[model samples]
Target: MRQRVVVRHSPVHGRGVFALKALEAGERILEYKGELIAWKVAVRQHRKQGVSGHTWFFGLTDGRVIDGGQRGNSARWLNHSCEANCEAIEIDDRVFIHALAAIAPGEELFLDYQLITDEPADDEIRLGYACRCGAPGCRGTMLAASDS
Candidate 1:
């Protein structure tokens, strides 16, 4: 089968996934693959290793996270966008990327990444999850709105 996507240096961030062919809306593009681990362990690894900026961690509804850094695929390169073209749908313990709208060839894939955190969305926390998607109505941060 022909390739569906490619990983390359991205202007929005470091690396990104780009569609190699036209994709229809609702098409299953790729699965966000990686090793499963608890959020606590991931947090420890992050702090102990001092991993900053870009991360390949995808959170699951079951409280576990997929550490894409361990065994990730091209989907890990999908950057964040306020106006995203794709959405991450979690089924069971696995997550899959689906096109939200028709995507043209060479267009970069993006996920909203409504990252939620227990800490207050203070300036420092917002800066940590700062978004560079450059969408017209960018929210500046990748975090989801708090129920405040």
Candidate 2:
């Protein structure tokens, strides 16, 4: 079945993506798009303001890559939270987000936005204008993955 991320009314981070069905552990959520660039190229691309800006690309020494740079799909719409409900682990050239705990039928799914980078957060980076995820240990700021 075509998986879809649904946004539900939340008390903490406004609306956020939730899985429509039970997603197995290590399930593939979506694959990132756009051309794969070298690490330096990706960094320079981040500096430029071009449309379709480069995403964090990965290439192993054996000429393989697992790029999940957020061009589109529900992965882009997914939000950040300190107490994220899910975690994405890279395996066999694919990025997968699985439930750390059993997510209920309608619970909003979350993954910590700041996990892999030192991305700064302001009003603009906040997805959907505001956050209301109501996750326990919720930080007041949207996209603030941690209070520390």
Candidate 3:
């Protein structure tokens, strides 16, 4: 099979994953590989990083998270889009990126980063995790609309 994707600079955010060839809907793209860490540890590391911008922690269903910042693959560069073309599926402690719709060659792959937060989404919180996907219906923040 040909190289299906590549990581490059993205207009949506910083770096992002882009499809190198046409992809069919429902196609399993790539696994989001990283260091498995507890949620608390992930939080601690994220805070320690002291970066105000992006993050690479992907939550898993089993209460742990994949710290993509360490030992991560190209999938970690995938950015968020309100009108996403891809979806992240967590299965058995692993997360995979899947095409949600037909994707054309050279198209940037996107996933709805419906990030959940324990606190209410106030202005300060929303500002911290602002969205720049530029989708028509962009929610303005990567944070989920409501606390989860």
Q: What is the C-alpha lDDT of each candidate?
A: 0.82, 0.50, 0.80
Candidate 2 TM-score, true structure as reference? 0.49
Pitting candidate 1 against candidate 3, the one with the higher lDDT is 1
lDDT of 2 by residue, 1-148 (tens): 3764575654444345777777655555554333444544443444463423322333333333334453544454455566877776656545556677766666677775432223343333333223344567766443334445
Q: Which stretches of candidate 1 lie over 4 Å from their true place?
A: 47-52, 119-124
Taking every candidate in turn, the Cα RMSD to the unseen true structure, in Å, is: 2.2, 7.1, 2.4
Worst 10 residues of 2 by lDDT: 51-60
- Give the clashing residue pairs of candidate 2, or none: 12-131, 12-132, 12-133, 13-131, 13-132, 13-133, 14-131, 14-132
Q: What is the per-residue lDDT of model 1 for residues 1-148, given as tens digits with 9 covering 90 to 100?
A: 3579999998888889999999999999999999998866765565554425576778787768888888888888889899999999999899999999999999999998876655465565566667877889888887776788
Which stretches of model 3 miss by more than 4 angstroms?
118-125
Candidate 3: tens digits of C-alpha lDDT, residues 19-39: 999999999999989999886
Which candidate, 1 or 3, would have the higher TM-score against the true structure? 1
**Model 1 TM-score on a 0 to 1 scale:** 0.87
Error in Å for residue 100 of model 2? 1.5
Please tell me which model should have the higher lDDT, number 1 or number 2: 1
Error of 1 at 30 (Å): 0.5
